[model samples]
Target: MQGNFWPDHIRRLIEQIGMEHPIIQAPMAGGPSTAELVASVSNSGALGFLGVGYLTPEQIDLEIRKVKELTNRPFGVNLFVPEISEAAKPSDKVLNCLQEFSNELGIDPPQMPGPPKYSFEDQLSVIIDHKVPVFSFTFGIPDKALIRDLIERDVFVIGTATCVEEGVLLEEAGCSAIVAQGSEAGGHRGTFGSTEGTPMIGGLALVPQLVDKVEIPVIASGGIMDGRGIAASVALGASTVQMGTAFLCCEEAGVPGPWLDSLLSSKDISTVLTRAFSGKYARGIKNRFIDEMSLLEDEIPNYPLQNSLTRSLRNASKDKGDSDFMSLWAGQGAAMSRKLTAQELVDALVSETYQVLKSIGTNL
Candidate 1:
């Protein structure tokens, strides 16, 4: 029953975005989401997302230019909502541990990174100036004025939510879509409101609930690996699905050779929610860094600070082919994943979804 309705709405939104499929390639902010990868995904009839959270406004312009060069299709840009946090300095003991870990990885003494590459205002301006087709935000909701400005410019706005209240807030704030990010998602937890009270809800539970509540279209994310997953989301009343981990193994991803190899080879990779990598709780493959830093959970500095502090070590680990020290982000569905081109993955997902629905109809 839920599957039959909302066609006109999703269809209009899809027409507005110029996407052939309702599938969205999750905007992985780190290294994996490259301009080439995003372009390829967009060219494949799906919405490609560029994670510009770490890039400067200049870099964002360059990447956008690159994607534009590669594909004439519409793609989306994701930004981290700017927040002001006070003195999130790490404790001496944790600092010593980080230093030792850096030494072990043969990394240079971590230079305290300058503040995040771009401010929200600067980045937002870049998007507006470029006349970006779609804009999405995480970490927290943007002010109503920003949303209004984007909407007034005819740019589709999407907000990520980890709970029902956040979804309601996004709808109220005028988002064209709400991405219900489940706990099984990799990279970062997009819990907007209270981080301390964030619910680690599973995708199936979270998607349907958000769908039931929101007036706008709800997108599902987290732990979705293949065709069956997409079908499941559609059945759960999601207008679309956003997948990050599934695309991690795609040929176009900018994942390090060793990290890609680790993702491909692992038959059963377990993920843990640790703030060790970025100071914000995110799910990633369990590794030595996470294990050794377990005792520092309470003291791990907040994001941007902790994220900047570990950049050198993460880069060094990638260079040295040490997966143990790398922030190997993967969702819970990593076990049943495959390596393919972006187009091939999307085609397979579409086919698999059809087959799953056919079988269900026959059985029922």
Candidate 2:
């Protein structure tokens, strides 16, 4: 119930982020992670995150200011590390598949997206200019120089890792902490390292491994939806836990109606890993888009390209209140999701964590 009860690493992280709880609301980019959601979670004594992966530098500045307005508590900003080269292009099959989806959604045919309006450096400038208390990144480790600058400015940097190798790479790259994102996590996979295939290690196995290999704290993520999951993460040596799907249906979350409804009704087997939505493996509830795209998994272009090609179609689906084409991102624990206000949810999680830990201590 108190910071003193937690391990030194956990306590240190909480203090470093100015949060009362060692919990972080996973930044769900594109939507779901709204300014209101971020602020509300931070106000609830846990760290919240603004997912600025898809936002321009200007938009990122505005969102950070908005969160500052809503909560004095420290929060974090998450970015997607740019990995795609300028010469990378989508294959014709990828474009034609998107075109078919566009026709079905009555949207214009897909086109190859131009380079980003701003570079990752531009985005980092906004984060540094604002002196954001916490910054996290996924997809890959950023350049050491940029990370050093952030650390020099006292910005607590967290990097996401799907495997121990990536975790070590992040530690060497100067990350203050690492988020051990399990395969069960929703949204985009944080895997950027070379692998035989996508790393499918679950949190129960991944957390302790990363903790053993890395000296810095490891934040367990993926399929962690409740206090029980949080306790399990701690037991496995994670300093804290990062949860996303658990908060997907929260009142302050910016989830679309159809996507929200899908999550509310999701079952244990409801989710599947697919690259259809973003060309990066992400777990989400099965829907028509994922089902149809499963056949073209090999043909789908890599991220940013595939993500851009389907942006209009996904938007059209959302606007039409259709879950078929919209990316219904949710973790495996979605069946346990509860619809509550951000404050109420955090309170519940803290209370439950206390109770669970107490019971475990007594039993041990």
Candidate 3:
């Protein structure tokens, strides 16, 4: 029965990506998606992806080892492909804007460090050496040679696309699959071309468009909460469904208590996409910081620069369990989120998908 509507296509995708189900857990960085969470998702017959951003290669290695021990099934690792901020030395403008917001939160903003310094090469090497089964990336595409290495090693390479152009680029770069990230998606927007003002497209529209435009499989992400959403994605021609907020409510998510509470209480309008947190624009719960900071965008530094400046404030908020200051990343379907175990959540999603398909005569 599982193989009927889902069919050999999904099973083949699972075999290609080394998973049992078509569900891929969106890799959310900043301590939300953990190895335990990934392993749980993997062990439960779904693809689990660990967000390996903002960490050193050694730190990533440690997490890989931990997940490997916890689950014998195949798991995935998500990385933030490095991108250069368009602003040349926009630190002064960013610092001034950050100071005002820091004052509101009653915290001191850190001084401008020179430029962003993270070893993408080293991280790539670690992923290759460890031979992670599925490697998904966001922000931007890596060089062609790096893509070749992953392909040569038979790693399933997934790239993010905010627009059809980005999807085309990923196809050209040899990505095995594409995650069509809609405007409602949490975390950073994967708008690659423009450094500023990328047009926002909803998943309902973006998924089918990308599917028609690209040859590779398209995974629907953003605002996907339950089985109906999963079936809708499949009906729209998506091969898989990737969700973040759905899992954030799971026991394995390990987010702060206050953050979880906020997500639970949130309505559809509760989330917003703001560059206030990381200067790269991520969709999260609209809080005091995002509202006030959005008023002063001109002063915000570009991505890693603004990202570094607010690290302390975000950390403090996380430690103190203050949802107001923390970047509570979540999709618009947050209200539909249920507090369940990872395995339970996966089961629910699968069940819901079957029912939706049955209702639509796709599962017959």
Candidate 3 positional error at 53, Å: 1.2
lDDT of each: 0.86, 0.90, 0.85
Per lDDT, the best of the predicted structures is 2
Tell me the deviation in Å of residue 178 in model 2: 0.1
lDDT of 1: 0.86
- What is the overall TM-score of model 1 with all chains considered together? 0.94
Q: What are the per-residue Cα lDDT tens digits for candidate 3 across 1-364?
A: 3544576556668777766678999898878788999999999889888898877889899989999999999888888888766654555656676676567667777666664455888887887888888998888899989898899999999999998888999999999999999888877898886444675899999999999999889999999999999889988889898999899988988699988999999998999888888888888998988987876777776787778778877877777778877888888899898999999999888888888888887736
Residue 196 C-alpha lDDT in model 2: 57
The segments of candidate 2 whose C-alpha lies over 4 angstroms from its true place after superposition are 86-91, 362-364
Off by over 4 Å in 3: 86-97, 100-108, 114-118, 194-196
Give every collision pair in model 1: none
Name the runs in model 1 displaced over 4 angstroms: 1-9, 267-269, 362-364
Candidate 3, residue 147: the lDDT equals: 90
**Looking at model 1, which ten-residue stretch has the lowest summed lDDT?**
1-10
Best by TM-score: 2
How many backbone clashes does every candidate have? 0, 0, 1
Each model's TM-score? 0.94, 0.97, 0.94
